[model samples]
Target: MSRTSVPPRRARTALLAAGALVLAGLGAVSVMQSPASAAGLQCSVGYSVNDWGGGFTANVSVTNAGTTAIDGWALTYAYSGNQTLTSGWSANWTQSGKNVTVTNLDWNKTLAPGGSTSFGGNFNYSGTNTAPTAFAVNGTPCNGGTSTGSPTPTPTDSTSPSPSPSTSTPPATGDLVDNPYVGAGVYVDPEWSAKAAAEPSGTKISNQPTAVWLDRIAAINGANGSMGLRAHLDEAVKQAAGKPLVVQLVIYDLPGRDCSALASNGELGPTDIDRYEHEYIDPIATILSDPAYKDLRIVNTIEPDSLPNLVTNVSPRPTATPACDVMKANGNYVTGVGYALAHLGGVGNVYNYLDAGHHGWIGWDDNFAPTAQLMHQAATTSGATVDDVQGVIANTANYGATTEPYFTIDDTVNGTSVRQSKWVDWNRYVDEQTYAQAFRTAMVTAGFNSSVGALIDTSRNGWGGANRPTGPAAKTTLDGYVDGSRTDRRFHLGNWCNQSGAGIGERPKAAPAVGIDAYVWVKPPGQSDGASSAIANDEGKGFDRMCDPTYTGNVRNGNSMSGALPNAPLAGHWFSAQFQELLKNAYPAL
Candidate 1:
């Protein structure tokens, strides 16, 4: 999809306050134009007048009508009655009472074989009139009979034959990936600040639409009830005013002590979790149901890590089922999640990507493919189909760069290094690209080509290549491991409180290559879960071990981490310098 232009001219203050409504209202105008025919080549004009109440801003679209290319052209016609042209674009417009002419804009001088372009103008007219006469292209007169009177008469039963149908081709659908991501995730104030600081220039975090995760919203204001912050959050969201930003949500509360049932995080008890589900997740889902949020896109994980851990780790150990009868089943969890996502109505612009654990977390033979099948079966059994679930995401948090990492059950005993290993693979070795390819290929190998693909977390990997050793040994390790299978699936980079320069990577090689699918700051960088202290893990210090209050670009052993903080005024200067250096490695313009 082409990136639509932002509104013409408006004050920053007014834009933040009423931009959404203004943009929506602007949608009523006829800004879109299409060729009269699709097969060969066709050109037609569309006009829209943006009257700031008094004058009008006229927008126009010009389409190509032939299969072969044309370099330059001019449009001319007689404007009989009271129409007077003021200004225009895509081409320059000039008029003298009854005569008008339009010349192509320098940048749009060429009308590619079957392509089209649009131009706009501001006009002052007392009333509508008969259409123009003597339409000509490149000084050659079109065959349409010229009009002599006020009301433009249609060319009826003339000797000139109608132009043949167009034969040009259209662009691909996946091109939709080119549209820019225009929203942000805010779970906490500090998280919001860090995010604001990381955005690039020409974009402002305050203007971008934002979504506040319900879990984070509840945890911030010392509220015992889930609805306590509803009004507060709505206000905070509006504070950015209206600049086309939107909110995203995830409903994590569910009843039942069954791990697979819903909302059963290993940390929370069954009863309390159920209440939080009913009071918190449910009401928020209701707020999302509002028509205002119809365009919202969300990743509804009733409980993330619900599947991978439940089937592989949680079900087997610790719980220790006495017999087959006592063992818990995966049906409730899978089915419940499906029902929740479909029924979680009212939210706008939402898309759900279920969780698929990291490549290092599970074994090759451990039935990764079957996991998708099981989820599908559960969803279908509960009347949900593959379509209900968008896709899946592979996550690696807490495990970070560590291998024997799954649980930190003993933070009091020994903070960072205490965890159990459930599989032979290490969960922290795969880089963004490697992990992306791993999950994509695995899904395909498991025959999920039609059903599932993967997304990777670039939240932590700052180094170019995987931290793991490379060479013959690395190739040997990957010999039997699938690496590039699910190339068709969405490849989003999951970052937390995204800093501008951090987590940047080489663009993907595919037609719409994967660098950052949505650039989702999934973890919302700044918030602490109360598990680790600032002293022991220093979350306040931000990136590396720089010990700075906020992370920004600074050189360390010939390596630079610039532009990591977008909103930081002091930090922006340093970031700008580093990006200039980085761009030196970019592809030269032809």
Candidate 2:
């Protein structure tokens, strides 16, 4: 999402005779083209690095200016003579000294008529502008020159754009960095709670949830603090190479909570709420309420699906009138939660997105509208004129699961999954575009506008939404089921949670839509839902290794029943991993 808005690359002032693509004006053959001909294809290759883990990623676009589609082509270029390809994809290559020959694979082959192809790779560096020489296509020289040897496009010694501060840098006010737990909102057990408490704290204000949780976050720059959640997350992200990861977390315990049925700290409801208010929530409110905390960006959920489930269950009670009808009664619950934070005085510090269950999870009419109204009423109850919450988030933890994907136009699920007769009223999963449109439309109808919006979990959507077909092979590749008999070889590393197969383009456009506030990752990747390998089915230890490493795109140690951070399962320790994954997903170009 951090894209550079600089002007497009211009033709190198100094052109080379060799790397130049000469259009013969002949049939089909436009001429010999060079990699430099493509936008962003720097005549010289080097990155403006911000830190060890973050830097500019090189995108080498090789357009087949030639009329015919080339089945396969190779890119041969020299780095600054010191830079190395950290990792690459879409093509393969062998490096010999300064000359690296990159060959396109079957999937990357075939440049269509008047069509162009682009292949990119990244390198790990920590400084600025180091140019290389002699780029070629399949051994043919490129740059701004001809096939015969010529001086490569000479890069001007002019200053290149400076890189932004690395996320490794400590959190400062007004920073809009991604929360590692960006997309995580799901059911987490008490074990995580116990583990989180037991984990050592690096900050003096350990009582403060923000301080305690983010103590290790700053260490992402390198090893800046005691090894805690961030360390494990860093390891997992590194293991993922450069792929984007989405981690999900469900904060079930709110203490003094009404939805205790869905979750309990195992502590008394009122007493637990006491601890949460003073020890956890209050302290978090204090820090985040500060202008400093507001400067720092992270996704914070006021509560999970408790409100929706409560309304769905209690709204029908004979005594209940239209829930959000008046702030005096039904709105009190939501306002009470908002009041505690509003009292903290950190407006806009946290992105408070309430829960809007998946289309399959709740109804659009009574359920969705009433919930949104409660948010408005809660703001009124607190005597706060501004909307306290951002927007409603749907599909909290249910990514990759076929049971539910996005909001439905019609109430097909009707708050239950048991009926086998329910058919999807419409089929929109044609592409990412369609999927995104459905999500936007559904939320808009549900009253999510510029001031409010939704967040989708992209993790586990890499394969089609539904579980892969039955059989061994089905269970072994990117599409294989997580619990199927097939070995763990099915999931994709970067896109495991992104159901791009739904044929929907990116949803909730980068900019906020009218009435839609911010659509961000509410669920980050890597946290487990208590299924350890030691448990019943393979589902047990599901938290074990992020998917079996035997699987194609695995990220962590599958053998360790213990989750990624601070060794074995720690209550809130998984949050650390989720946070770190969100950072990687958000700042991949870094």
The regions of model 2 sitting more than 4 angstroms off are 1-252, 256-276, 290-294, 315-335, 344-348, 364-366, 383-386, 400-450, 461-521, 531-590
Give the Cα error of residue 146 in candidate 2, in Å. 85
Off by over 4 Å in 1: 1-191, 194-213, 216-250, 254-268, 271-277, 299-302, 314-327, 330-332, 345-348, 381-383, 396-453, 463-516, 529-590
Error of 1 at 298 (Å): 3.7
> What are the lDDT scores of the predictions, listed in order?
0.35, 0.35
TM-scores vs. true structure, each candidate: 0.40, 0.37
Kindly list the per-residue Cα lDDT of model 2 for residues 323-411, writing each as its tens digit: 22232333334544555434332333344555554543343344545655555544444433333344455555433232232332232
Count clashing residue pairs per candidate.
46, 79
